[model samples]
Target: MVDLRALFSSNDPVGSAEAFTNRQNQWGLVATAIEDHLRHIADPGFNVEDLETSRNNVVHFHGVGGVGKSTLLRKIEASLTAADQRPTQ
Candidate 1:
């Protein structure tokens, strides 16, 4: 598991981003809820071959500041960007 205490304890945003990126380097479940939500948004059905049939293309995560909201957004951005670049079967 990621030492979230250490991750969010960074002195700056750059350090925080670096720590967030390295979180998956270790074992353990940290933010399954956030991860699962990101995966659900990246579903092929949402961005399938028929753009006209697509429902929603955007998702919003709302909460008070300093509550790991930015962290979740950055993680999801990385996750979805990687997924979009992958070769399909």
Candidate 2:
């Protein structure tokens, strides 16, 4: 559900290239899912849109113990890639 368009977008270019790119991609996934939330719920009339985008939106999913953050990222990436292959409206 992540808006693949947002993945290539960046509100901040004020950091290391690698880190910035990763952050942008991550947020794109989160935003996409969020934006599509209403459609996902079978409420066709309700829609969500992202208005204020910020550099601070970036979140590092890091931890020492067990967590599926990385796995989730990978899964999202794969799903988005597949979705992109489909024709867009």
Candidate 3:
């Protein structure tokens, strides 16, 4: 798993964003994908304890009209489909 403490605990917001985006916690199916990506790094201690964590299932956003929220969601859906990512969020 990725170490997020350094990113959030740091002073730079932009760097934090970069680190966060680069590190995504995917579990169940998404976690499976993560495991696949990290298969090469397989250590005997790969318990993946972080994957056991739960997150809110909701996607929250607030914006003015015609802000492409639907479009953005659709794009996300398409990518998930391509990745065969089942919703466990």
lDDT of 1 by residue, 1-89 (tens): 55657645764444444433443522123355546657866887554466566353345565433445567555555655677674342
CA lDDT of every candidate: 0.51, 0.48, 0.46
- Per-model clash counts, in order, read 1, 2, 2
Q: Which candidate is the best by lDDT?
A: 1
Per-residue lDDT tens digits of candidate 2, residues 46-88? Answer: 3346345332324356642222455546655665576767333
After TM-score superposition, the amount by which residue 2's alpha carbon in candidate 2 deviates from its true location, in angstroms, is: 33
lDDT of 3 at 84: 62
Worst 10 residues of 1 by lDDT: 21-30
Sort by lDDT, top down from the best: 1, 2, 3
Q: Which regions of candidate 1 are displaced past 4 Å?
A: 1-54, 83-89
82: Cα error in model 1, Å = 4.0
Task: Tell me model 1's lDDT, rounded to 2 decimals.
Answer: 0.51
lDDT tens digits, residue span 2-76, model 3: 455654465543332233232232224444644565673475755556577553335454444333444444545
Which regions in candidate 3 have their CA more than 4 angstroms from the true location?
1-55, 83-89
Cα-based RMSD of the predictions, in order? 9.6, 14.5, 14.3
